[model samples]
Target: MKTAAAAGEAEFYLEPMIVTAARYDNSAGKPGYYKVDEKKLENGNYDNALDVIKQLPGVTLMARGASGGMNAYSKILLNGSDRYLVIIDGVRSNWNGSSYNDFDFSVLPAGMLESVEVLSSAAGSVYGNAAKGGVIRITTKKAVEGVKTSINLETGSYGREQENILHLGKSGEWSWSVYARKSIMGDYSSARQSIPSYENVENAGIKLTKAWGETADLTLSYSVFSGRYKSKIFNYKNTEPDETKPPKLFKNIFMTDARKTEDNLTLEYERKFSDTENNIVGIYRRSSNAAYDRSLNVERPWLLDLRTEGFFDRYSKQWHPKHTLTGGVEYYKDQVLDYQDLAAKYSDGTVISKAVHLQDSWQLADSVKAVGSLRQDWNSYAGSKLSPALSLEY
Candidate 1:
């Protein structure tokens, strides 16, 4: 008889493990954090991050069209609307500099991720406005102790094909890793066979880490992604239906040919003062350029540039034999440059945001704990706002 581990490996070709922090835990007391590792990602036939996120609890994947096209938009919803924030390797992945504040998961490839953490509660006090709903954090694979390289290829119906390559190694005080992937799909008929749609995506990323002595570590990472999609538009009102056949839809005034490119760079430095004390500083820059071509043959372009820098300091100490105290402070600055109107060039503007937050956790008793957080934010458009949160668990 096959053991549980053997069965899981044979089915998914990866190990199976899940770690969760519930709201009613005794130690740490932090709640609603769930981790999904690489093995869980391979359990399903997932191509993109959205596909894997759909399987998570308390999440709903909503989409409209059968064909994945530029016109179709999908979102991951928690208890409410899709207002969640996405962070990759501690950097905000959502393109807040653009008109659309929501993060698009379709373009995020699943092959590059080593793990995903979902915090299914309001974290506004700690993460600012973007975390009003929740937060989804992604971590990429790190360099292995030994040199290793792997390649993967997959093909499916609708002429879909994908290829990926990854390499990682560690030597002395330096570690490095790189990954790349490309996917393409042939044109396919839409729901009513009224339109044909297709999409192509390519992405690559690299990370380099260096240890400065035993107390300090530094990491630099960069990633680039580009995608293009074409789809036809239909008129819902102008439809013809027959008794034995599906409805015939009228072609709209415009079809869509859209393209987008994103670039992200991040640098992080960390120092450990003690076993329970640490400090971190990070800086990141992201830019996105998008173009849309309508059936009229007119092209419209958009550009979004964003830069963020932040620092955090945390310490944990035991006040008594049975009581523990943890405290931390964080500060960050976000700047966004957006080009709104192209023809007139009059809608160009910049938004600056600065925030600082402090949090403390206290263990009151053997089964009781209290967590408190306070934050202050200053925005160019919205002025200032204060957020506070307090939670008690027993």
Candidate 2:
């Protein structure tokens, strides 16, 4: 990864070192990618983000507890319908929740990431109606010109340990980026965040990108979270924790809590439309949230989330020979308010998950290539689906 005129000059390569092309970490390098970093979830015994996708490849990360209260909601099945899609830069983590916010991935901010891409499927004809079980794009960290900083500290074992983190970048041209993260983990009746159970969180994020002339560019982002957990029906002497299965390894006695807050906003664009290829993005996101479960003390089972998403694309990186083409169009809007705090409360409902997409890819030589896609989902009353797919790469 060189720029700024080949940065530091560390030549030790034969091939494969180039790094950026706007793809970021592509997680496990395609074929169901999995890139998770943060010292691999702070070492020993993970308990969130499905323990880092349960270690990649055809992923699976079922949980009942490990930190964070609440369970069941992460069913990312691709070939069998479950529709999984999450976007940090575009903010679209809605695919019908309950999977505990599907891939909490520790509510993001993995020390201010710079890459995290997981596709799970050739994208089933491209981003349409929640990506039909695949798409996790996260590219954080921008604003660079000078003054860069980062610091992190960690400790292990139950009643685990952690220290604050800070990353800052600045250089003018109206550039700025800031991040702060706090973590507290523990709850191992013998293994993994043991608590009256375990979990403690405080997170913050901010980003700004500028450069108004040249070709065109603008960006702004924000993230905030506050969480406290230990409650899962106060552990109820370790009983039900089913999504598929899991609940035995040394149980946690009892305790309760759940606090939440999530925010997101982004706007971006790039242009170059007349070279060999270029006409990148036009992204947008606005997410809202509020959740509370003070050990069932009150607040009437709170959970409120409002959403918005959109992305327009036209990317082609190859002129001839082996090819590259990413066709895209995606949109989503959701409004949900769930309050079941009992003792008399508020209940609201809203569901409108929409989708429209197209895909293309043809290369026949090089490594071998062929891909196709078409997706449509519009709901005035549940009726729309036309998925076509084929994949090969070797």
Candidate 3:
């Protein structure tokens, strides 16, 4: 870097970067955006994360996999306020009266993640209206100075299962880190047309962070998951099991169970004048859920959703010589209540919610980007949307 800018030292660039706008940084990639590298899993394991996002380039997937199945029902937005602006590390993964309730990459153990920031389209000035079909940002793993660890295992076939992760870290100035993960996905499957299959999945997570002095940082994270997808799934034989046609058989029976839990807490502050750095952050998130239709467990209908969310973000930065600027502004509030019960319903499924938020992302040139988002919503489909987004790079 021109001999470290002539010894004043300031040459930063590294890590498998790949971030299409959304105000870059995204760690690992010092400056030149587009960061990818931590474990290479766009969908190597498959079964979700949109199977590596349908395969990028225009991004589209149909009848491929990951529950977007019955045609398509996956929603991700930013810049507007689709599930409080769908986020990952900053928390909030979509849900506030259903955006199809994204985030079920089977349980996102994707090599414990470290990078993956995809803002597919309609950047809503930066990330709004669920980004239309964008925003899949995830950046995990940080807390370095010393000590690092990793472990993963995989098996195959219908009764297939396996997964394990453990991470430890220590950097300095009293820094600390800890993360844990576990998974078991069995009932790999044993029928396609004759029927009889089961799928069981589980996922877990834990994160802790600490740092004092010079600025300040504290973090706590917890995640939990449960899964149940009974099988007997297959499509074919539009007709023909017949001797007389009246026996033209067709059967569709399968049950499913799901549960999800998430918790997050963050507090950060940074004050530096000379190096030109600014940051103030506070975040709190919580989500609890349950679902079941059992395909028709005697009558179909059982779902409960409870959510609590709060997000406050602020970041500022400036670097000279040539020019480097970072900007941030965010505020989010979420409240939701969902209830459903039916064996033969008449009028009893309802959802009540409330929300308030704002978003901003700017980086004018390093690669070019801009984003703006504002949101206000209340209860069962009230109304409000103003999303803006733009990005340019060559």
Of the candidates shown, which would achieve the greatest lDDT relative to the real structure? 1
What C-alpha lDDT do the candidate models reach, one value each? 0.64, 0.56, 0.48
Number of the top-ranking candidate, with TM-score as the measure = 1
Question: Residue by residue across 1-394, what tens digits does model 2's lDDT show?
Answer: 5597779667775865676566443224334446666555455344334445545554554443434323423344433444576665544544344444454565454445655566656654555444555676666666566766666667887666656555666665667677666777666664554336566777676777776545555776766666676555422233656747775544444345566556665666666555556555656655545454544344345455555555556455555644556555555555555544334445455555555565666667544556666666666446666666777754
Query: Of the candidates numbered 1 and 3, which has the greater lDDT value?
Result: 1
What is the C-alpha lDDT profile of model 3 across 1-394, one tens digit per residue?
4576598966888899786856533443222233344556644664334455445433443332222111123343333334433456655465533534555544555555666665534332232344554555666666567776767776776456666665667766544444344444344333554334344545566666665655555666666655554433232233665566655545544444443344444544444444566565656656555555445343444555555555555454555433433434444544436655542333234444344444445555454555445454444545544333334432
Backbone clashes for every candidate come to: 0, 16, 32
TM-score, each model?
A: 0.74, 0.29, 0.30
lDDT string, candidate 1, 299-393, tens digits: 34433444455554444555464444444455555554444322533334556677676666665665565667777778878798887878775
Comparing 2 and 3 on TM-score, the stronger one: 3
Q: Candidate 2: minimum summed lDDT over ten consecutive residues — where?
A: 64-73
Model 1 gets an lDDT of 0.64
Pairs of colliding residues, candidate 1: none
